[model samples]
Target: MAARTQATRLPATDLVRMGAIEKLTTRQDFETWSFLVTSMLGQFDLEDLIDSTIPRPAEDHPHHDRWSRLSKKVRCWLTLQIDSSIVRELRDESSTGWSIAYADETYEVIRRIIVGHAHTKAKSTWKSAIFMKREDYGSVEQYVTAFRQHVKAANLLKTPISPFCASLLLLEQLEKELPGWTGSIEAGFRSDIAETMTENEFHEICCAAIDEGNNDNADRSKPTSDKPRSSDPNGNTSSNLSSSSNGQTHIQKHRMAPPKGKSARQYVAEWRAHEPQRTPEGNYNYNIVR
Candidate 1:
């Protein structure tokens, strides 16, 4: 990742359009700004922004009490970062005798905007940053340095973060906690949280299933000499049961049926002639012969 450039001064007109810049210089005039910032977070509407920030009596809503409490924290954080008085007013209003209608609305809106925008930006930034880090997986220091560079790069791009930083910090903490398990920094950052079973472990499960299947087949193949036969009306003769190599008890008297239709080799050849085999379900699919 490339180094991030310094922040530049944005035009006043653009700031005003985004509601980041306000004409209000006094405490009373800052109400409009509070409302606008709240709306961006999806907490309040344009009308509410003006009324609550201005402390206009008629414009207040009953529901804003809850919002007021929540919006204060976010507004304060935003204010500190933005260097705007209106932002400060919103932050200050968060709990200071503010109506619930104003607080809840502002809190929700600002939180939403921060969360939603930060997530969107973080996804793009993390992907690019992590990919580059992966390419230089041999050195952990280099990976972290690159990651930080990417973050600075993202900030330079005017991306919202306050929300994203925590997740990244947690990832950093994980590295600190397990310093010995180091390999690739990018791999650490980019790997999915859900741990997958190793291939050998998975194959053992399959092998166990196969063994069970063979055992079931052997049991089914056992001859049933105990079955009543017409030849022994009095049932004077009893069949001898012996264990077979397949772990199945079978009667010695049971005879094997002769191969039908064609010889084993010939039958196999004929079966192979059919390019694709049709399963019992009548679906044509490829199969491998052992």
Candidate 2:
């Protein structure tokens, strides 16, 4: 029994307190998490899995089983420390044809990720984004998501302000975007657990507002239909299509203007509304003066 116990026991150096690390929520959180996580891997004698000092063997190789096990252990330690949204972003990078080869990447893949983010720079840009709203992005959803990202980037910053101050800042930003929002919303945004940005609570709170904004946008874009029908100079009824060489109108497969109610004014409004370069601020942006 004593011999079996001795055989099963790991060396003192091989054991590490897993609780020593925290989840990596932002670039600010990366440095500390990376150092501690690397130390933990080293303590377990698995540093080689992430360091690129050793090459991996093919699956059929004799030593492949050991390498695969160690690589998985290292990968688990790395990923389990990241925020789930961040995890999804990392996994989604593969679709963008980035450096990572697969969504479920090995520790060496994690190592590459770390190498990309471990650069030493700090900026206050995220501070400005804390107040970010609809000035930039086209949709309410895009604007909302950008605001969430800015807050997330600010998450792990060492306090120039207290956590109490941080919550107040978040509240102020929320109030700017949503004038009447208060009570439980203020409470949730103020709470660290509720608006972590990785969590769905904040998003769920604003879903109604988002849908309403989009629906309002849709309604405004719809053309008015009560006008009397007017034929083109060529006597063609299809206003959305082009005049054929023989003075007949041909239906254009690619033209998107309304068949029934489109007028010159409506077409211009739609054009400016959909223009990517034009910065729109809701329905007010549709009107153009000569």
| Highest-scoring model, TM-score | 2
Model 1, span 180-258: residue lDDT tens: 3322432554344234434343233234333543555576799976543222223344345568899999766643222
lDDT of 2 at 162: 34
Which digits, one per residue and each the tens of the lDDT, describe model 2 over residues 62-152?
5555555545545656677777876787687656665443112444344345434322312464455545646567876676566655654
Model 1 ranges with Cα > 4 A deviation: 1-81, 85-123, 134-139, 148-290
The stretch of ten residues in a row with the least summed lDDT in candidate 2 is 2-11
Q: What is the C-alpha RMSD of each candidate to the true structure, in Å?
A: 20.1, 20.2
Cα error, residue 61 of model 2, in Å, equals 37
Best by lDDT: 2
Runs of candidate 2 exceeding 4 Å displacement: 1-122, 156-198, 225-290
Backbone-clash count (model 1): 17
- Clashes by residue pair, model 2: none
Pairing residues by index, what is the TM-score of model 2? 0.31
The deviation in Å at residue 43 for candidate 1 is 23
